[model samples]
Target chain A: GAGVSQSPSNKVTEKGKDVELRCDPISGHTALYWYRQRLGQGLEFLIYFQGNSAPDKSGLPSDRFSAERTGESVSTLTIQRTQQEDSAVYLCASSLVTRDIQYFGAGTRLSVL
Target chain B: AQSVAQPEDQVNVAEGNPLTVKCTYSVSGNPYLFWYVQYPNRGLQFLLKYITGDNLVKGSYGFEAEFNKSQTSFHLKKPSALVSDSALYFCAVRDADSGTYKYIFGTGTRLKVLA
Candidate 1:
C-alpha cells in the first residue's frame, strides 16, 4: 500500500462488547506499532511488533487489550469487554525498521456507549 | 523510562511572526527526538527528527528542531507562522542507550496561528 491504512474509521460499540481495529501497514514495513489517544491527551503506546521477534506488550493498558500482527502484514487490536474508558482513537503506524521514521494511519475512533 | 514533556497546552501566534513550541525530554544516555504535527481528523504527520550530528535538524514544511543534550530539550521552531500551521504538535523521545525502539510521546501542544 502507498501508506498505512486503518479500517472502520469510526466505531460505536456498547460497553462490554468486543471491538477489533485493523491496520494495514505500508508494504515492506517490518515494524508495526499501536497507540491510543484520548481527547485532550497525548498518544499512549499500546504495543510494538518488530520483524517476528517477541512483541513488546508492556504498553497494553490491561489484560482486556490484546493485539496480533500476522507476518508483518495486517494487524488487529482487540479490546474485550470494552469499558467506557476505552473510548478513544486507536492509531497504527509502520516503519521500515526499528528506530526509523514511522508513517501513521488515519486511525479508528472507537466510542463505547 | 523515556518521556517527553510539552509544557504548553496552547500557543497563539500571529501570522508572519516567528513561532516556537517548547519540548523537553528525559531518557538515559543520548536521545532520538522527533516532532509530529496533526491536523483535525487527520493522522499525525512527521515533521522532523534528530538522531546525530548537527544539533539543528530541518524537516518538512520549513520546520526545524534543535536538540540540546545538556538541557534535554528538542524545541520546534519556524521563522514565520502560517495560518495553516495551526495544529497539534507532539514531541517524542526514544532511549539511545537502551536500544528500545519505543517512543514516549508528550502531551500535545495546540498551536493557533492567527491571520
Candidate 2:
C-alpha cells in the first residue's frame, strides 16, 4: 500500500484481557512509530523502530506494553492486562527515515471494559 | 528532551476569517518544527514543517506556519478559515542537532470554523 495500514480498526476487550494491535508501514520506509491517544488527550509517543537498530522504547507507558518490528515491514503492539486507562486510539506512522515527514494510519480504537 | 506547548484549548472563527493556532517549543540546538491536523476518528495528517532557511513554510491545504527562533514558537496560520477546516491541530518539535531523532508533540488545539 502507498500509506500506513493498521488493523483491527476497533477492538473491545475486558479489563484483564490482553490485546494485540498490528501495523504495516509503508513499503521501503525505514522508520516506524506507535502512539496512544486517550479520549480528549494528545498523542502519547509509545515506541519507535528504526530499521534493525534497537527501538526507542522510552515512551512505553508501562511494563505491560511491548512492541516488536521485524526488519522494516510489520510491527505489532501488545497490551497485557488491559486497564481502563489503556483504552485509546493506537496510531501507527512511518517515515522514509528517522525525523522525516511521517504518515499516519487510521488508528486502532481500543475499548477496555 | 524536546517539548511543545499549545496554549489554546480551542479557537473559534467564522468562515472566511483569518485564523491562527498558537504553538511554542522547548528544545536544544536548532529545532525542526511541524504541524499536523486530525479529523474526528482519523489519524494525524501532516500539514507543514520548518527545517531551515525560511522561517515561513507553506504546506498542504493552503496552510502555513511561521517559525520564530527567538520566541521558540511555530504558529500555524491560514488566510481564510473554512467550515471544513475544523479539526484538531498539533505542533511537534525535534532538536536538529540531537541524536535521539524523536518528535515531541503538543497537547493539541481544537479549531472550530463556523459557517
Candidate 3:
C-alpha cells in the first residue's frame, strides 16, 4: 500500500463485547506502532513491533488489550470484554526504521456503548 | 522518563499573522523532536522533525520548528498563518540515549486562524 491502512474506519460495540482492529502497514516497513487517542486528547502509545516481534508491550492499558503481527505485514489489535473507557480512536503507523518518521493511518473509531 | 509538554490548549491568530505553538521536553539524553498536525476526521500528518544538524528545521506546508537545547524546547512556527492552517498540533520527543523507540507526546494544542 502507499501508506499505512487501518480497517473498519468506525466501530460501535457493546461494553462487554470483544473488538478487533486491523492494520496493514506500508510495504517493506519494518517498524509498526499502535496508539490510542481519546476524544480531545493526544495519542497514547500502546505497542511497537519490529518485524513480527513486539519488543515493547509496556503501554497496553490492561490485560484485556493484546495485539499481534504476522510476517511483518498485517497486525491486529484485540480488546476483550471491552469497557466504556475503551471508546477512542485506535491509530496505526509504520516506519522504515525505529528512528525514521512514521506514516499514520486514518484510524478506527471505537465506541463502546 | 522522557516527556513532552504543550502548555497552550488553544491559540487563535489572525490570518496572515505570525503564529507559534509552544513545546517543552524533558529527557535523560539528547532528544529527537517531531511536530505533527491533525485535521478534522483525519490522521496526523508529519510536519517536521529535529534529529540533528541545524536547529531550524523546515517541513511540509510551510511549517518549521526550532530545537533549542538550552531551553529544552521545540516550538512550531509559521511566518504567515492561513485559515487552512487551523488544526491540532502535537509535539513529541524520544530520548536518544534511552535505548527505546517509544516517543512521549504532549497534549495537543489547537490552532485557530481567524480570517
Taking chain A by itself, what TM-score does each prediction score?
0.97, 0.96, 0.95
Query: Higher-DockQ candidate among 1 and 2?
Result: 1
Model 2 chain B scores worst on lDDT over the 10 consecutive residues at B94-103
Q: Give interface RMSD for all predictions.
A: 0.7, 1.0, 0.9
How do all models score by TM-score? 0.98, 0.97, 0.97
lDDT of 2 at A113: 98
Docking class for candidate 3: high
Q: By TM-score, who's the top model here?
A: 1
List the candidate 3 regions with Cα displacement exceeding 4 Å: none
> Better model by DockQ, 2 or 3?
3
Among all windows of 10 consecutive residues in model 2 chain A, the one with the lowest summed lDDT is A93-102
Give lDDT for model 1: 0.94
Q: At residue B9, what lDDT does model 3 achieve? A: 96
Q: Which parts of model 2 have CA positions greater than 4 angstroms off?
A: none
What is candidate 2's DockQ?
Answer: 0.76
Weakest lDDT window of 10 consecutive positions for candidate 1 chain A: A94-103
